[model samples]
Target: MNDNNKDDKTLNHSRRQFFKISTALTAVALTPSYILKAADDNMDDKIAELFEKRDLNIEVNGIVHTLSIEPRVTLLDLLREQLKLTGSKKGCDHGQCGACTVHVNGQRVLSCLSLAIMQDGKKITTIEGLAKGDELHPMQAAFIKHDGFQCGYCTPGQIMSAVACVREGHANNEDEIRSYMAGNICRCGAYPNIVDAITEVKQKGGTI
Candidate 1:
């Protein structure tokens, strides 16, 4: 080939290689910026949530407590996990079971379905709070007397609901007691005994 033709071929090859290298570098630079930005945004969101917690001030069973908890924390978790009040069982965390029943502002509340952060400045009563120091509440005593529980896993919630039933004036009769206490489910089938206990408590008529 002539020298002029050879020089022209070399120049064309060099130009092609330069464009290839520039395109590769540009893609590498541009692709990483988008990927890195997405990664950074995800990391920022996780970091923000990791330190996110709200202050909660509330009373439980006549004792006031100040706590800091995540907004997603449920009242049942706050009692069992944080405050160590495990009497309110965690059965059926979806609120189907009554094992997590407790009192919030004098009404029966399903703790598992309730958010602790939303209960700020509210009064909560767990099964552990039903008794006065070493003295069982009347409903607790009645439950024992009537053998209202067998496995006893559902007893705490049962007793709590029972107290609420009597206080709510729903225990006027056996049928009424059964109707109000229906929310509490005893796997051992202690409904009859539970009804008996609540009936006795209601009939006593002193202080529920």
Candidate 2:
């Protein structure tokens, strides 16, 4: 009777182990597809977010452009990277050197510090746009005449600020031009020539 009892107990334990193994195998086989589907869904969402772009419509150099840009992109990057307008140099990206200066709605601004999204429906003027088909703007002509640049890396920003200085009526004299154009740093020490360019433009009433 005791032997019969022991055999029955062993049979029950074997059945339990078999059922547990079968359940685990079923779960393992079925869970992979579900887990893979979940991972695929997550990857799709991440790809969509990574490629998200905002529509941008702004006039550049008298021509209007419709662009798709990321929110974190700066105007400088949009101009240089997307639009192929590289006249504006990326110097002192911190907005301290003023090398990324450009005109927004006729007001000089630091493009490196300005976001492209915020400039929708605005007029932007870079150094490339400062000239017509074959004629240069008065400011450009004056800079050339006065030899306002040395290495020319900072010339674009210097010219833009100089134009603004004249338009704002801040180019009355040497001191005023220096004070107003202080934001632009010409490492070549072309301060005197820059002042000369601005003063000439002011005296001649140069067209901005």
Top model number, TM-score: 1
State each candidate's clash count.
0, 0
Model 2 pairs in collision = none
Residue runs of model 2 more than 4 Å from their true location after superposition? 1-51
Worst window of 10 by summed lDDT in candidate 1: 42-51
lDDT of 2 by residue, 150-188 (tens): 899999999888888898999999998999999999999
Model 1 steric clash pairs = none
lDDT of 1 by residue, 1-208 (tens): 6785566567545654554435434434555565345444544343333334556888998889878677889999999999998899999899887999999999998999999999999999998888889999999999999999999999999998999988888989988888888888888999999998888889999887
Q: Model-by-model lDDT, in order?
A: 0.83, 0.84
TM-score of 2: 0.76
